[model samples]
Target: ACTVARQKSDLFHKYALRNAANLLKPEAYLKPLEQKIKNVSSILKNKEETVLNAWHYRKKIIDEYLQYISFKRNTDKVFVWIDEHDECFVSKLEELDINDEGYMDFVRALK
Candidate 1:
């Protein structure tokens, strides 16, 4: 589970940071990536103690995604995306059962 989560996070970073500029609609990539992270985090949640690295990796992915959006000068899209999926994102964060600074900072930033 940990390995899979790391790989998925890595792939998300690759696309989000490296290939994002090439895409005409970068926000189009956000939903799927979000879903993938949610799924991986869910799996890692069950093994929380043993998979601490995976949770940290998940945090890194979120940080990188935020950085990517800022780099593209599309900060507004972040709010739009959150608004569109606010409940889902918040609920997933709650379910993860991890005290991830990135996740907390994200929620705080949204406020």
Candidate 2:
């Protein structure tokens, strides 16, 4: 689980950075951001069950990115995705038992 979490986290970070960089480019030169966001979102959705914290972190990154973009553009599409994913991540976090030995070990290893 930890190994999978690490790998997913790495991929999320990579795409998040790439997306941010692309966003900074002039509009004419920018790459499509939707694909990068989708990639990270898919990773989070697929791995959330096994690594909650890692999923949380990656989801948070994508949420922030969406929020940032939404603020810059007049679009409702991004909000829809944010609302849907927010429910899933929140429910998962609520289900977590912080005192569990395995969970603590996973958190420690992440540190």
Candidate 3:
């Protein structure tokens, strides 16, 4: 899903670059703003597989934790909770640490 989201964002970037009527756009704007292309380049680069795996792992954990706690709150704010502490949720929960890092890390790394 993170891959998809990045792809979609890149798609949008491509389209916008194609249709851009003004200055170069975000990338262009960022470069001079930062006075460094490397900074902007790093931001634009796809994440390493390890980082992407970590994010996927993080997402899976939050999703499970959300499901686990959904009924307890009147108006569940699952996304925020998931976002804030996914590391812990990923680190300890069975669903999140599916890899059995003695935890859920395995599950998160699957795909």
Q: Could you arrange the candidates by lDDT from highest to lowest? A: 1, 2, 3
lDDT of all predictions, in order shown?
0.74, 0.64, 0.58
For each candidate in turn, give its C-alpha RMSD to the true structure in angstroms.
29.5, 28.2, 21.7
Count the clashes in each prediction.
0, 0, 7
On residues 36-106, what C-alpha lDDT tens digit does candidate 3 reach at each position? 43343345454646577888999999998998777656345665676677777655665432444533445
Best by lDDT: 1
lDDT of 2 by residue, 8-111 (tens): 65676666666667665533333454455457666666666557777788999999999999786755666676666766754565478567777666555433
Give the number of colliding residue pairs in candidate 3.
7
Candidate ranking (TM-score, best to worst) = 1, 3, 2
lDDT of model 3 at position 93: 63
Model 3 bad stretches (over 4 Å): 21-48, 51-111
Q: Is candidate 2 or 3 superior in TM-score?
A: 3
